[model samples]
Target: MRILCIGDVTSPKGVEHLRQNLWRVRKENGIDFCIVNAENAALITGASVNDAETLLSSGADCLTGGNHTLRNRSVYTYLDDSEYMLRPINFGEGTPGHGYTVLDCNGYKIMVINAMGNINIEPVLDSPYSYIDRVLEREAGKYDFAVLDIHAEATGEKAAIGYAYDGKISVIFGTHTHVPTCDEIILPRGTGYISDIGMCGESGGVLGMNPELVVKAQRSRMPIRFEAASGAPRATGVIFELNESTGKVTSIKRIAF
Candidate 1:
């Protein structure tokens, strides 16, 4: 199956760019599913319901999130009701939304799992690695393919998880750093792995934030409000082809537009 996995959508501009370009990209690439990260969208611009809707309208089948998933209270209501939206699985047993979602595209059943890293991130109920194993154990042969979104800070931790689940899962893409990594290759076990998919927002700014404010805060060592960068926005992601028979990745490529 052809799947498009986008990195974090940080601001409204990123959403707009996706809305404008995603449909065409999907058609041209023969993409069957599109998964995007939306954790930083709301945090970068307060509340971004429009951004979320735009992403879905643009062709994203599902949206995943990380530490900033709960930054906006409005998303709480949506998370409770939207099946297409997911948060980290390690958020404890009573979390509102599901950490993973299963979707039927044509005749293929695709399972998308979202997990947050523990290193330098907020404390959660359980370790993501263990959580992923539990989920996979319960739904192993039930799905045609399994995709994982590892929202993390440390590249080592992300790489470890990808390798740990190497042959078990189809694709494992990292997020949270907003900087795309050079490593994009299929694991020995046939799983597609990328250290990071990067962010879809301002390319000139520092990790999608306004450079001026970031520089001021760093120079003065004072708390300052960060704003989304304003300029020509870009989109970043990865495309993966999975083998239906073995539930492994056949090939993977990075996408930057």
Candidate 2:
């Protein structure tokens, strides 16, 4: 099975770019399933209902989220209603949406999990370790393969989690930092891992935000509203090829264009 995991979408431009190009990427790559992190798909914060819908229609089989997912109240309902749109699993009970989902496709049951790191993040949640442990235990024997999207700010934390679940999960990709890492490898246990997949927005901006605005805010030591950089956007991510019999990744490839 070939799964394509996309990075964070930082703005409407990013969303539009995906709408225009993602289908072709999936087709050319022979993607069996596609996951996209879209917490920042709005102008500067959480994805709206329309943004989520646009991405889903454009080719994203499932959508994962991060810290900014709840920034917009308007999407709360959609998050609850959509079976494949997820927030952090450790967000606890009563959260708008779920953190994991099992999709039945191509004669296989694929489980996708979304979790957030506790380090250097707000509203400190439960340990990602414990939450994922519980989910895997509870869902054992129900799914054929599992993939994780760890929305985290710390590379070390992401790497630790990836190693911890190396043999258990088929693929583990990090998000939230919006900068693609060069390190993409299949662990000794056969799990595919990457520190980050990068963002789908202006390639020249500061993590997708207008560089000048970010600089002004930092230099002036004041809160300045950051806007998405205006220009052509690029999509960045990784594709993992898994062996159906072993439920382990056979290879990993980075994609950026």
Across residues 1-257, which tens digit of lDDT does each residue of candidate 1 receive? 88999989888778878888999999989998999998777545333566678788889999999888877777777777877888898897666678998888869989999999988776544679889989999997788888999999999999999899998878999998999998998888899999899988877899998899999999999989888887789988999988778878888888889
Clashing residue pairs in candidate 1, if any? none
lDDT of 1 at 81: 80
lDDT of 1: 0.86
lDDT per residue (tens digit) for residues 1-257 in model 2 = 99999999999989999999999999999999999999999966799999999999999999999999989899999888888799989997888888999998699999999999999987688889999999999999999999999999899999999999999999999999999998998999999999999999877789998899999999999999998887679999999999999998999999997
lDDT against the true structure, per candidate, is 0.86, 0.93
Report the alpha-carbon TM-score of model 2 versus the true structure. Answer: 0.98
Per-model TM-score, in order, reads 0.95, 0.98
The regions of model 1 sitting more than 4 angstroms off are 43-47, 123-125
